[model samples]
Target chain A: MELPAQTFQVTRADLVRYAGASGDFNPIHWSDRVATKVGLPGVIAHGMFTMALVGRAVTEWAGSPDAVVEYGVRFTRPVVVPDDDQGTEIEVTARVREVTEDGLTRLEVTATCLGEKVLSQARATIRTAR
Target chain B: MPLDPSFVGRTYPPTAPYQVGREKIREFASAIGATDPAHHDPEAARALGHPDVVAPPTFPVIVTMAASSQIIEDPALGVDYSRLVHGDQRFAYTRPVVAGDELVCTNTIEDVSTRGGHGFLTTRTDVSTVGGEPVVAVWARYVIRGEA
Candidate 1:
C-alpha cells in the first residue's frame, strides 16, 4: 500500500533549533560563508534533520511514536535551505514493501527536496500498529 | 591522506553515561516538528506502554554523534574534520529510548577503505543502558573528500 505523502518546511530558524537540540554545530549547516567555502550551494539542512522529518512521517503512518524497529537512509544529496521567509520543503513518501508474519511492516521510503532526491535506500521497519 | 584500513575492528572505550531527559526529548521533537504526544507527555507515553516520554527514532544521533568523536578525533586516524561528509546512517532498535534512561555508547570502527582517493569510514555505535541492556545499534558512514 502507498502511504500518503507528507511535506515538511525546513527553515533557518528550525536549523538553529536543531543545532542546539542535536548538538551538531557544523558551520556548513548554518554559516553561508563556511558553506560556500565548502562548495555547498549555501547553508544546507543537517542530513539528520532531514532523516528526523522522514522518521516523523514514518511514525505518523505507523500510528505510534515508538513503532520503529529499524530505520536507515543514505544521504545522496544535500537539502539546501535558501535564506528566506520561505525556506524549503522536503517531501516524504513511502510504500509498504512487505509485512512479516510476525507483524513487522517494512516501508520503502523516499525523500525529495525541490524535485531532487535527497535520500536513497531509505527504509523503515515498524511493528504493526495495534 | 587516506584513512588506515587497519583501524577497522578497533573498538573505543564506552562513553560516559548520558541521562535521557523528558524535556530534551520534547525539545528535539519540537525541533523536528514531531508532534506526537508520546515524545512529550509522560502520561501519553505510558498510555502507549512506555515508561516515560519516548524519544523520536532519530533522537539517538545526539548521543551517537558525540560518542563517535573518539574515532573522528583520533590523531592516528588523521581524519580532517573540514573535509568530512556524512554518507549514510542506520539504526536498529531493540526498544525505543524513553525519559530517565541512562545510556552508554561504545564505538567500533567497522570498515575503512579508500576509493578514488576519497576515504570511507564506517563506525557502529552500540547504545545500551548503564546496566548493559542493549537499546539500539547505530551505524554511520562518513566520506572524507580528497583535496583536489
Candidate 2:
C-alpha cells in the first residue's frame, strides 16, 4: 500500500542550524557564493539532512521513534535552497515492500524535491510490533 | 587522483569516547524537525524502555564524521576534502542510542575505486559503547569529483 506523503520545508536558516547541530560546516551549504563557485546552482541541503527528514517520516509511520532496524539511501540529486523564506520543499513517500514473520516491515522510500528525485534506493526496515 | 585500492580492509584505531548528551540529541532531532517525545523527554524515553532520550536515526553521523577524519586525513590515503561529496549512507542499528552513553567508533576502509575519472571511497564505522557493547554499524560512500 502507498503511504501518505509528508512534505518538509528547507530554508537557509534551517541549513545553518543543521550544520551547527550536525558539525558539517561545509561552506557550500551556507554560502551561495561558495556554492556557485563550486559549480552548483545554489546552496543545497545536506544529503544527511534529507535522509533525516525521511527517517522522521518513517518513524512517524511506524508509530515509534526507535523502530528502525536498518535504513539506507543514495544521493541522486541536490535539493537546492533558494536562500529565500519559501526555500524548497521535500516530499517523502514510501510503500510497504515486505513484512517478516519476525515482525520486521520493509519499506521502499522515495524523496523528491521540485519534482526531481533527490534520493534513490531508499529503503528502511522497522520493527513494527516492538 | 584515484584512491588506492590497497586501503581497503585497513582499520583505524578506535576514536576517543564521545559522550552522547541529552541536549545534543535534542538539538540534532530539532534541527531535522524531528519532534518525537522520545527524542526530547527523558521521562518519555524511559517510559518507552530507553535509558534516556534516544537519538534520531542519523545522529551517529555526528560522531562518525569526526572519527572518519582518521582516514580522510591519512597522508598515505590522500583524500582531497574539497572535492568530496557524499554519495550514499546506510545504518544498521543493534539498539537505539540513548543519552549518557559513551560511544567509540572504529573506522575501516570498505572499498575504493575509480570510474569516469571520479574516485569513490567507502568507509564503515563500527559504533560501540565504551564498555564494548555493540550499538550500530554505519557505512558512508564519498565521491571525489575528477579534477577539472
Candidate 3:
C-alpha cells in the first residue's frame, strides 16, 4: 500500500533557523560561498533536516507521535535551497513493505527534490495502530 | 586521507549525560516547522502516554552528533572532516525521548572501507539513560571524498 506524498518547503530562512536550533552552523548550509567552495551547487539543506521531515511524515501516517521504532536513510543528493521566496520543495512518499505479526509495519520511503531522488534506501518501522 | 580500517570494532568512552530539555525539543520542532502538539505540550504528550513533550524521531541526532564527534575528530582515527559528507543515518528507539531525561552515548566504529579512493566510515552510538536504561541506538555513515 502506498501512502500519500507529503511536500515540505524549505527556504534560506528556514535553514538559518534550523542551524540555530540544531546547532549545526556548518557554513555549507548557510553560506553560498562556502557551498560553492566545496563544489556544491549552492547552500544545501542539512541531511538531518531532510530526515526529520521524513520522520514527521512517518509520525503523521502512523497517527501517533511516538510510533516510530526505527528510521533510516541514505543521502544520495543534496537539497539545495535558493535564497528566495520560492526556495525548494521536498516530496516524500512511502510504501508499506511489510507488516509483521509482532505489530510492526515497515515502510520503504523516497524523498525527492527537483524531481531528483535526494534520499535512497530510506525506511521506517512503526508500531501497528491498534 | 582515508580513515583507518583498523578502527572498526573500537569503542569510545561514554559521553557525559545530556539532559533532554523541553524548550530545546520545542525549538527544534519549531525550526523544522513541526507544530505537532505532542511535541510541545506536556498535557498533549501525556494524553498520548508520554511523560512530557515527546521529541521528534530525529532529535537524537543532537546528542549523537556531539558524542560521535569524539571519534570523527580523534587524531588516531584519521577522518578528514573537511572532505566528509554524511552517507547514511539511522536510529532505533525503544521509546520516544522526553524532556528531563539524561541520556549518555557510547560510540563504536562499526565499519570502515575504502573504494575508488573514497573512504566510508560507519559509527554506531548506543544511547541510554544515566540510570542505565536503553533509549536509542543511532548509526551514521560518513564518506571521505578523495581530492578531485
Return the TM-score for each candidate structure: 0.99, 0.99, 0.98
**TM-score of candidate 3 versus the correct structure, residues matched by position:** 0.98
Per-residue lDDT over B1-148 for candidate 2, one digit per residue giving the tens place of the 0 to 100 score:
7889999999999999999999999999999999989999999999999999999999999999999999999989989999988999999999989999999999999999999999999999999999999999999999999986
Lowest summed lDDT over 10 consecutive residues: which window, candidate 2 chain B? B1-10
Q: Candidate 1 chain A: worst 10 consecutive residues by lDDT?
A: A121-130
- Candidate 3 falls in which docking quality class? high
lDDT of 3 by residue, B7-92 (tens): 98999999999999999999999999888899999999999888999999999999999898899889998888898899999999
Sequence-dependent TM-score of model 2:
0.99
Model 2 ranges with Cα > 4 A deviation: none
Backbone clashes in model 2, listed as residue pairs: none
Pick the winner on lDDT between candidates 1 and 2.
1
- Which docking category, incorrect, acceptable, medium or high, applies to candidate 1? high
Q: How many clashing pairs in candidate 1?
A: 0
> For each candidate, what's the DockQ?
0.96, 0.93, 0.93
Q: After superposition, how far is residue B66 of candidate 3 from its true place, in Å?
A: 0.8
Stretches > 4 Å off in candidate 3? none
